[model samples]
Target: MWQNLDYVSERRADTVMVLSGDHIYKMDYRPLLAYHQEKEADVTIAVMNVPVEETHRFGILTVNRQGRVVEFTEKPKERDKGTLANMGIYAFRAGVLHECLPRYAQQYSDLDFGHHVIPTMIAEGYRLYAYRFDGYWVDVGTIQAYWETSMALLDPDSPLQLYDRAWVVHTRSYERPPAKLGPQARVARSMICNGCIVRGRVERSVLGPGVYVSPGAVVRESVVMNDTWVGPGAVLDRVIVDKQVVVGAGVQLGCGNDVGVPNTTYGDHLRTGITVVGKAAHIPPNIRIGRNVVVHPHVDEEDFVSYGDEVPSGETI
Candidate 1:
C-alpha cells in the first residue's frame, strides 16, 4: 500500500488518506483533514480510546496534550500503556511519504504501518498528530468480534445506527427481488435482506441476501449469509453459515452443552460457542453438529461419513 505514495506524488496531491476495508465505522474525514492542516502535521493517524485490556489487539499509542503522538507500539503483549488505538486510518503528506517510504524499505524488513512505519516516523522526529474519534467504530478483525458486531446491529440503541439519514453508509448492492415471508414464517428482531424467502422461525438473527429458509427450520442467534438454504427441521443456534451453504433437514447445528470445547483448528477464534460453516458446504441430513464445530468450505455431503451422523463439539470437517 505504501507504493501508492508514488501515485500520490505523481497526482500532485497534498495529502493521501489510507483506510482499512475490514472496519465498520461512520466518519466524516473532512474534519480530520482540517485538523491535520491546522496542525501542519506530516502524518495524522486516527486514534480511538479502547479499553486498556483490549489494547493488545491494536496499535497503541501515547500522545501529548497537544495531540502529538510520542510513542507507538503494535499489538504489544504487555498492554499497560494508553488506550489510544490506531484505527488503521492515516493521512500523510504526499511528499513526506514519497520521500520516506523508499528510505524505510531499506531500513526495515517488514512494511507494516503500525509495526514499522509509524514508529520509525516518531523516532525520526516527524510531526505526527492523533485525531481523536469518539464515535462508533469497530475493527471486526476476529470471528468473535464479527459475530458480536453483527449482533450489535440488532440493538435498537446501538451506537452504529443504520437508519440515520444524516450520514448514510452505502454499499454496492445487487439487483434482487424483495424478501418474502411465508404464511407460517415467524421472525423477530432479525434482519432479512433482499432476495430472501423465509418460511421458518428466525429470531435474533441476520440473514443475508438470497437466503431461503424452509418450513420447520429454526434459526436463532445466528448469522446466515447470502444464498444459503436452511432445510426443513434444521435448528441453527449461535451459528454462522457462510454463503451458498446447504443445511440439510433435521440437522441440529450448534447443538449440545459442550460450548466450552473450542474448535480444533481455529480454537482461539471459535471458542465462544459459535459454530462456523464455511461457504458452499453441504451438511447432511439429521446430523447433530455440536458447539464450536467448523465445517470447511466446499465440504461435500460424503465428507460427513467419517462422523457417523453426530459431529462432536470442537471438531472440524
Candidate 2:
C-alpha cells in the first residue's frame, strides 16, 4: 500500500486520507493525525462500538486500556470479546505509507489495503493507536437500513443531524431555489429540499430536488428522489423513487387496502412492503403498483396492469 502511495505522492503533492464509501459517517481526521504524530505510531485506525448483532459484519478490534491495539479480527462471531470495531477510516504518516505499500505489494500483488496491508502492519510491532469515534455512524448497506437512515435525517432526536451548520453533510448542488409549498399543499412531518414544488398532501416523506407534487396528490411514508413528478391525485405509500422518476396520475404505489394479495413485483427485498422506483423511471397512467414493488431505471411506458413489471419506456423507465 505504501509504495504505490509513494508513487502517487510524487505525482500529487498532498496528504491522502482513505475513506469508505458505504458507511454514512462524519469523522474529523485532523485530530487523529495529530494524535498519530504525537504518539509516533505507524498507523492509526478509527474505531467505533456497534451493537453485538452487527459486529459480525465488521472488522472487530481488541485494544488495551491505554488505547493500544492488541488484536484485529475480521468479522468475529463473538462481538462481546471486543467492543471496538474498525470504522475503515485511516490516517497514515507519509513515511510509514511509503514503507508499508511496497512490502504489501510484493506479498499480495494487488492494492487492497484492508485485506493484507493493515494486518501485516499490526503484526510487525509498529505502534498502533485506536482513535475512538463516539458520533452517529450508520452503515446503510441494505435497502431497509438505507430507508431508515434517510428518514433519520428528519428526526429531532437523531444523533446524525445533517442540518447542523457546524458539521453540515454535503451533497452535490442543484440548480433550483428554496422548496416551495403551493397554496393547495399540505405537508406534515416531511422534508422537502430545494427545487421542489409541493401542491399536494405530503406526510412522513422526503421529497428531493426538483420534485413536483401536483394538486391533490398524497404521498405518505415514501421517499421521492431528484426530479420526480408525482401527478395529480396520485397516492404513494412507503415508496422509494430514485432520481428523475415520474409517477402518473392517480397511481397507487403500495398496498393500502387488502392484505392477502401479494405484490410480487417488489420481490422479497422489502420486509414491510416498501416500494422502490429506480432512477429516471416512468410509470404508466393510472397503474396500481402494489406494496414493495421496485421499478427499474429509464422506463417510459404507459398502460401497465401488473405490479413489479419493469416499465417498457426505454428513456423514462
Candidate 3:
C-alpha cells in the first residue's frame, strides 16, 4: 500500500529524507530521528563503513580525532581505508532545508542533496551528526547489486527477512492473487511477488508483480519488475528490466555474462556490472541487452543499441 507513493520525502514532515529505493533492507527511522532530535542538529546522516574496495562510488565522510565532522566528499576519487560513507538517507531540519535548498538551487541547479547540499552544510558549520548504522543494508543501484542484494534475501544468514510478522517490506500492490505456478512450472530459491504467472523455470531471481513468464522461459539470477512479459523460451540472467518491458520469445539477456557488466545499453556504473534500466522503459523482444548497460527511458525501435543505450523522450529510438 505504501508502495504506490513515491519514495521522495514527504512535505509535512519536520525532517525530509532521501532513501534508496532499490534496497531490500528494512529499518526503523524512529531511533535515528530520535537521536537527531536529541542532538538538535541541523542534519543527522546515517553512515556505514563499506569495504575499501567499494568506497569509490559513495559519498565519503571524514571526522576529526574526536569524531566531530571535518570534511565530506561526494564520491571522492581516492579512498581512505576506514572512512565512513553517507547512506543517502539524510534527516534534515525543515528550516535548514528552506534556508539552504533555495540558495542551493540558485547555485548548483542540477545538484542533489548527496552531491551538493550535505557538503554545503558541513562547510557552513551546521551541527552535522553522524549516526552509525549496524543493521542490514543493501545498495541495489545497479544490475549486479540488484542481483546480489535480491539473492541475499534467500540466504539463511541474511539479516533481511520479508516474512517478518512485525516489520513487513511493503511495495506497490496490484491486489491480485499470489503467484500461481502452472503444472509444469519449475521454481527454486526465488522471490515471486503477487499477480505473477510462473509457467517456466525461474531460479535465483526476483520477480515483481504482474510478471508473466511464458512456458519454456527460463530466468536465472535476474530482477524482473512489474508488468513485464517474458515470451516463451526467453531467458534472462544477471539482468534488470524496468516496468512494462517485454521480452520477445527466445530472447537471451545477460547470458554468458560476467557479474559486474550489463549487456543492455545504459550508463556506466560507479562500480561496473550494475546494469540500470530506468523506469517505464522498454526492451524489444529478441534483443540482447549486454552486461553493464545503462538504458534510459523512452527507447524506441531503431538504434544499434546492444548496450548502454539512451532513448530520448519525444523521439522514437
Q: In the order shown, what is each candidate's alpha-carbon RMSD? A: 1.3, 4.0, 6.6
Q: Rank the candidates by lDDT, best first.
A: 1, 2, 3
lDDT of 3 by residue, 1-317 (tens): 02212332354667766577756557898898998889887888888888887778788888766445677887777776356888878787876777777677778858577778778888889888888888888776654566677788767666886678899766566588888999979999888888999999999888889999999999887788888888888877766778887676876665433544323333344235444555566565666554455556655544436433322211122
lDDT (0 to 1) per candidate: 0.93, 0.75, 0.71
How far does residue 93 in candidate 3 sit from its true spot (Å)?
Answer: 3.6
Query: How many Å off is the CA of 272 in candidate 1?
Result: 1.0
User: Which run of 10 residues does model 2 get worst, by summed lDDT?
Assistant: 308-317
Q: Candidate 1: which stretches are off by over 4 Å?
A: 77-80
The C-alpha TM-scores of every prediction are 0.97, 0.86, 0.72
Residue 76 of model 1 has an lDDT of: 76
Query: Could you give candidate 2's per-residue lDDT for residues 127-212 as a string of tens digits?
Result: 77889889888778767788888778778777777677998877789679999999999998889989999999999888888999
lDDT of 3: 0.71
Index of the highest-TM-score prediction = 1
Q: For residues 238-311, could you state the per-residue lDDT of candidate 1 as single tens digits?
A: 99999999999999999999899999999988898999999999999999999999999999999999999899
What residue runs in model 2 are displaced by over 4 Å at the alpha carbon?
1-7, 11-16, 109-111, 256-269, 302-317
Q: State which candidate has the highest lDDT.
A: 1
